[model samples]
Target: MIAKLLSATALACLATISSTASAQSGSGQKAPTANPAQPQSQPNPPSSKPEQQPTSKQPTADRSKLIEEAVTAVRETRNAVRAIDQNKPADAISALERATGKLEIVLARTPDLALAPIDDAVITYDVIGTVQDVERIRAAAKAAFDRGRMQEARRLMDGLASETVLSVTNMPLGTYPAALKEAAALLHQGKPQDAKRVLETALNTFVVTRTIMPLPLARAQSAIEEGRTLMEKSNRTDAESVRLGSLLARARDQLRLGQALGYATEKEMSDLVRAVEDMERRTSGKQQARGMVEPTRPMFDAANKASQPPKSN
Candidate 1:
């Protein structure tokens, strides 16, 4: 048999978001480093075409961490790939057997599973700035996207959002087990070339999904809380009132940023902004601002809550 080279491209580590710091420099704030992959929403990875980039990219450190709790089938798949790379057919067959055995255990528990989850990690990216900054970046990103400059578009929009993104990878239960079994049989038939191709196909059948939590909305809520704390104080000093005004402005700014980033509907953000600015106007004269930020809380709360975490099958 002719020695065939197996093509297995493991996911490359997500590129670090270096430009966000420069983007946020105007606000003197660093975008959340909690490790978000991209500021944009992404679809699940396609089981048929694994060559395309995933909607969510994991930071290198987080990828290393996810490997710590590796699922048995996934790890075995990696082992099988490695064995193929080293031209060790026997080892590859052994790894596939172990993988199938694990799947048997899993399928026995959940027979109707569609896609079995392998692992997930949270990736966060935050771009902290006032409304003007968001507008500037949004325009640039739109132009870049229109020009079909995806990398440029992604970079420009990266700092326009403040979000916590969760990326998950799963194996398609419908076909993966069969592929493993077929690869094993191919090996037994003394066709390592064919077996290697089957294994590669199996690896690419994994799908990925991303869930996003808006950090800007949360920041707005935080600002409102801080302002409310001051309002709760009796005999508030003029300086405190001025500080309250600043906080209200920050809250309004965050709301506007959130709106630009499409975290909330225009109407929803508009209503909140109108209310916040109205309160802000009252606080302008250094007078005690009277209002409960609690009413405004529900909208932000609802938006954040809507971004449910990824569920493993």
Candidate 2:
């Protein structure tokens, strides 16, 4: 069976970009280098203080091992398909039996698992543009789409986001075992063609999911965290205050960007802005705004989590 892969670039083109005009009043033009196809930065842990160009970490070792353990079954399944193509019914059934047995071994160890993760990919749409730019592109795309200019619409939408996409592929446990049994039954009934179809269909039954994370929100979160660290520095000076203000200001800008890009509502963003302002006031002349940022953190965390949509292409 051929692998179904969603490379970073492929994911962006296939997935619909979330865009709507919600530019905040007096929003400054802070275009981030004008390229929407840059690689994503790695997300830092909550306690991390340094600047990080967030990288999507590889699937954890446990998941990698799990998928590796399931490969024998996948390979045997492929062998069964090959046997069917070669018209060797006996070989095909033997391959399938071996495949099924291997799958059983894998499942027996992890009975509670539903879908076994097979593969994953990361997509970064690092668009560098202001809110107005997004609005203009979105409007144009919508107009073109309405007029049935699909190509034009797609072109307009090609680089229309500032976010990261995570795609996971999983093998369905509930239906796959049953499917294998059914295919085996069909083969025993002298229906090699039907059994082959079943096998092929089952091979392609892997499920995929995508989670969209707004980079703007992530940036906002990062900015606040960095600012928090700055506040903890000994004897905060005037220069430190200026940097703190800039960090707060950047967080506000990113929040506005997130709202404009449809990751969050205007009301939600406005409330967040006020929250940032409150933090700003607390840190104006103080050497410790550490606790100040903490109060607004949960709100930022909640908003960022809400902005992510569990969608797929």
Candidate 3:
């Protein structure tokens, strides 16, 4: 009976070992199946990468189109001014309106276009011809100003000033006198601030110095006088008055510019003094002439009678 029991125990142990091995094999197979599902979870294919989207590039071509539009608008405006000079008022007005509209579009699209080239072209083309195209721009600005279009007037004046400066840039020193004359008009029109700014900018050119012996000093004095006159005529609260203050500040700036350019020489200073004296003499002469024109016969007779009677008494 004991041997039979032992044999039975050994058979049971063998059965248990077989069952454990089968369980181990089943688990190993499930692991591979789990790995297959993991690949499904990684649904993103190599073809579906984030970089596959189209890249947004710079709109260089678009910018070029805007610049072309701006250039065309400037040219059209210039042509319109020429028509105005030929006494074609209607045609000129119509063309100018169209040009203004085109420029508006360009400005709306791209406001920061470098206008130096356009400005240069406008002045060069107008000043050399009988067109007086630049004058038309000034007229437009004046009309705008009269109509309470302050911003519009400012824009037009700025454009005009820029163009004038550009035209004189390449000219010899002799051209500054004429340029200053043009600038003076702008100043007289209550745009003294603009005049000062333009003169300051034009003085940057070496040609201006090459032509005038004491170029920097002369410019500084002129700027200072312009500022002083404008300030005297201005009301402190008005925009134009404020601009006059700016002109005065710019005059001081021109003095500094003269110093920087080495144009502040003894001769220049002497010339400045002489100019001041001449101006004073002219002013005094005019005052004297006005006094002489006064109607003072009655007062003179009264004074003469009083003196004669006092002597007789």
Best of the two (1, 2) by lDDT: 2
lDDT of 2: 0.65
Assess each prediction's global lDDT (C-alpha) against the native.
Answer: 0.61, 0.65, 0.33
Top TM-score hit? 2
Candidate 3 error regions (>4 Å): 1-58, 111-313
In model 1, residue pairs whose N, Cα or C atoms come closer than 3 Å (at least 3 residues apart or on different chains), thus clashing, are: 35-124, 36-123, 36-124
TM-score of 3: 0.21
Native-to-model Cα distance after best TM-score fit, residue 276 in candidate 2, in Å:
1.6
- lDDT tens string, model 2, 1-313? 1123543333223222222211100024445332343454433212211111111122344334455656666777788878888989888889889878867865776676676655556555566777777777778888999999999888877766666665556678878877878888888998988998998898898876555567777778788888987776767888888998899889888887777677656677777878878777777775465576777666665665566553344
Q: Per-residue lDDT for 190-272 in model 1, tens only?
A: 88889889989888878776545566676677788878878666677888987887888788877777787777567777887
- How far off is model 1, as Cα RMSD? 11.7
Off by over 4 Å in 2: 1-63, 139-154, 232-235, 285-290, 310-313
Order of candidate numbers by lDDT, starting with the best: 2, 1, 3
Q: Of models 1 and 2, which has the larger TM-score?
A: 2
Q: Deviation in angstroms for 144 in model 3?
A: 54
**Residue 132 lDDT, candidate 3, scale 0-100:** 39
Q: Write the per-residue lDDT of candidate 3 for residues 1-313, one digit (tens) a residue.
A: 0011112222222222221111100000122110111101111111101111111111545434543444454455445445544655455445545645655665466443322112111011001111134445557778999999998877765422100101101222233333444444554465544544544554453221001112223333444445445433423445555554454444444333333222334344344334333333433312211231122223222221221111111
